[model samples]
Target: MRRFKHLFFLLLVITLVPMTSCDDDDDDVEPSRMDLLTAGEWSGFAIFVNGADVTDFLASDEDEPIDVRTWKLKFNNDGTYTIRGDGVDPSPLQGEWEFTNNEQAIILEGDSPGDTQTVEINKLTSSELFLNMTLEDEDSGTSIDGEIRFRR
Candidate 1:
């Protein structure tokens, strides 16, 4: 009777094993980059144009090198962002920002439509944000492709 009971128990265990399932939905889900961008404020990391230093232009009328730490960017949950200068320039540019191209690019809208830009996101993390923008320098009358990096 004991042997028969053991045999029945083994059969029950075998039958239950196939009924068990493991869920992986959580593991398959990817965290959104937009969520990370809106996580906190970020400061300028670096700015380059055509493989040259053009960050001096980031400031409006400053003779000194712009202190990157003073520049700020804040992305909000409402799909809006704010850009501020470090007082590094006499007239620092500040404006609104948004994600476009299905969240693949960021559009920084200046006071006028002609001053707006659509930048591709190279990388975005809790601590770092990298972007590439093609811009036309109204003063220089030259088209420029630039890379801008920021850090938290």
Candidate 2:
């Protein structure tokens, strides 16, 4: 009877060991959607109208440029975004945005008609974030494929 009791106790511990070990690993699990969105502020450079670098546009004060439209983009943890440029009003252009998932994508709706933009997040860090986006314009020939790198 003593030997049998010892075997049973050992088997019980073996079964419970795995369960306890799993709990330890739970702390390393992925963060929730809101947790990720609230991680930090993402600010970076952007180009609009294709073929104009952000700096060139800013330098020329919205003069015709090449390869990108110059602007600064800010994304906040509170679900707001801001865009500032020479020819545009920053306040009306700034608004709320939401991530499609915990992954790299978000939908931004502006305050004006036909002002919505969809951004695909490329990378994010403590001090910077990168994104790829195309503006909504059917008349334009070339698609606005570009990268935005923002600093905190």
Candidate 3:
């Protein structure tokens, strides 16, 4: 009976020692950039053009103001994205997105031939994303340099 008691105690310690010695730091490991970007849906928070605030207006129209508060832009892990809102063309914009420039930039290819856009990533965090893009104003034949900020 004493031998049995000691054997049981030894077995319990052996089993618990490995379990307690595990490196718990694995739980604190930070997520990668791709993991952060695709974690959830993001919406427009602000837009700037040529150093001017333009979040309330359409990129091509100064007379009309667009309420971008309802917009939803989602980046998926499968390299696809969808943008929907009051001002988005074709109701919802669907496209394929890819990370470029060593993951420092992003390129979006939309349905139309002229819908290709390359935007530099100004910032990317778990909750916020900022992109700098150079867009051409088709009506004015001028380039529009801007930053678009999004939040999750």
lDDT of each: 0.74, 0.62, 0.84
Best by TM-score: 3
Candidate 3, residues 82-131, lDDT tens digits: the string is 98886677669999999999999989999988889988999999989988
Best prediction by lDDT: 3
lDDT of 1 by residue, 35-68 (tens): 7888888888677877776666665445444545
Clash count for candidate 3 is 0
lDDT of 2 by residue, 29-148 (tens): 676555644565444455533545554544464443322234456667677877774444453268788887566688888877777778887766555566777633244565657665
Error of 1 at 27 (Å): 5.1
Ranking by TM-score: 3, 1, 2
Error of 3 at 128 (Å): 0.3
Find the 10 residues in a row with the least total lDDT in model 2.
61-70
Better of 2 and 3 by lDDT: 3
Q: In candidate 3, which residue pairs clash?
A: none
